[model samples]
Target: MLHLRVISPVSRTEDVLAMLRVQPGATHIVLTRGGALDPEGDAVQADLARECADEVVDALEAMGLAHTGAITLEPLDTVISDAATRARRLAPGDPDDTVVWEELIGRTREESTLNATFLAFLTIACLLAAIGIVTDSPVTIVGAMVVGPEFGPLAALAVAIVRRQGRLARRSLLALVVGFPIAMAVTAVGALAAQAAGWLSLERIDEIHQVEFIYEVGPFSLVVALLAGSAGMLALVSSKSAALVGVFISVTTVPAAGFAVVAATVGQWHVAFLSACQLGVNMVGIVVAGVLVLVLHPHRRRAFRGTQGARPDRVW
Candidate 1:
């Protein structure tokens, strides 16, 4: 469940309310009315409160009726009701877990740009993974996993499909298409340098049974990516920083790209192909899972306007 606060001019009250009436999972509706101070022509204020289970907030905004109004929806940490019986009536999903769609995509859009920040993050992630592969150190590999910025593109793709935003979809695709190959090339160059300096041996490339996890492209990879994508979307929707961390560690993009570079450095084409396939499979899984989850939890416009720090009243 999610809390919605909508504020609009009195003239649009009926229209907004009518739309809310048909809303799928809205519960606990509240309405408040206020007049303008200047009193020009009855352009009073109307506030409507609702709790919704569905994720149609973004779609609702596109409808254009209340598009111009001032509205806000936020997570309600606690909903306290006096009657235990009434409290039982509340839905199963937690309000804190629910996410507003536009807000979510907005964040993704802001982060998905192929700017200097993206390049910096990507470079760090790839370099760390490359070091891990070369040294065969699990710690560095994990660190690289945590640092990888592939989640942005993956999340962007999910948001694009869920919201049907073609531009977002294309941009995200570009990021992945360009980002992965670039990271691989960089790692390859680094590997070549290391080999020349006698820091890494080409003969050691084929003896990678320990690092098979990075090269294996199987159903399990898909499963992990799906779970990661779900958690990533949940984190984005719920504004949970920890969940985003989980997303960073769960995807195999970094390791695969790094391993591919290692293989290229040593002329191990088979290993490179296998690692690239793993990367592709993980990316597909994450995007598919994210799209499914977001479709289930669309965004809705809110019905209240507050000056500042006005929290929701306790009601379960």
Candidate 2:
């Protein structure tokens, strides 16, 4: 379920109420007339099924609420009312399959932006993976995957291509273009430091099963990347982000980069080259999978067409 908070201009208040009253998925409509001081309008609160959110938001946008007023959607942790249950039952489709596009664009726009914190997390994640590579610990490698911030920008790139947002495309590309090299360089320095401290050695890289997956490019890697990318995108659009943790560990993106750094730092040039190839393969596979998923979904196809058809003044 989703909570909608709307501000409607004085003249549009009746229109807003009429719209909500007819929506089967909306319940518990509350209105406070002449209550808003900022824009001098009415305040409205309603509960609606998550599957129905996009339609309601689209209607509101069409009515120009976005220009004169505001509309906000928030996830409800709990909705115990019978009205809420009925709303969910009356909703047209499965909530998880619905594309809440406004919410999605807002999310990826924030995540794709290049920032210091993103850089720091990316570098730290690769460093953790470098340690995991040196020690041959699957547990530590998974930990590094959990910390990695690369998925956000990668996902952003997929979304940008599908939506035809040139600015977003550039921003997402910038994040990846700049982020990976910086992360790899820092991990290389960390590898050298670990060797100097006697905490790592080149010998472990040859024997570790986990290291082989990082340093070898294989058919199975592409299959895993496809599955992980699809699952990761599902997690994003469905708001079931817990699924993304598995996606993170399943694809050896950061781990491969980290392994490459460690191998090159220790002068294992052949292993480094293979690891780099593995990293490239995973990156391309994930992006392709994500794009395929978005393109394949019927709802997203309609949404994409709408996005492409909209005038430049209209933003989703």
For each candidate, give its TM-score against the true structure. 0.70, 0.91
Candidate 1 segments exceeding 4 Å error = 1-93, 296-316
**For model 1, how does the per-residue alpha-carbon lDDT over 5-70 read when each residue is reduced to its tens digit?**
555456665665666665545545566655323321112121112224233343334333234455
Residues 138-159 of candidate 2 have per-residue lDDT tens digits of: 8898899899988888888788
Best by lDDT: 2
Give the runs in model 2 whose Cα sits over 4 Å from its true position.
196-204, 207-210, 308-316
- Residue pairs with backbone overlap in model 2: none
What's the true lDDT of residue 308 in model 2? 52
Query: CA lDDT of each candidate?
Result: 0.67, 0.85
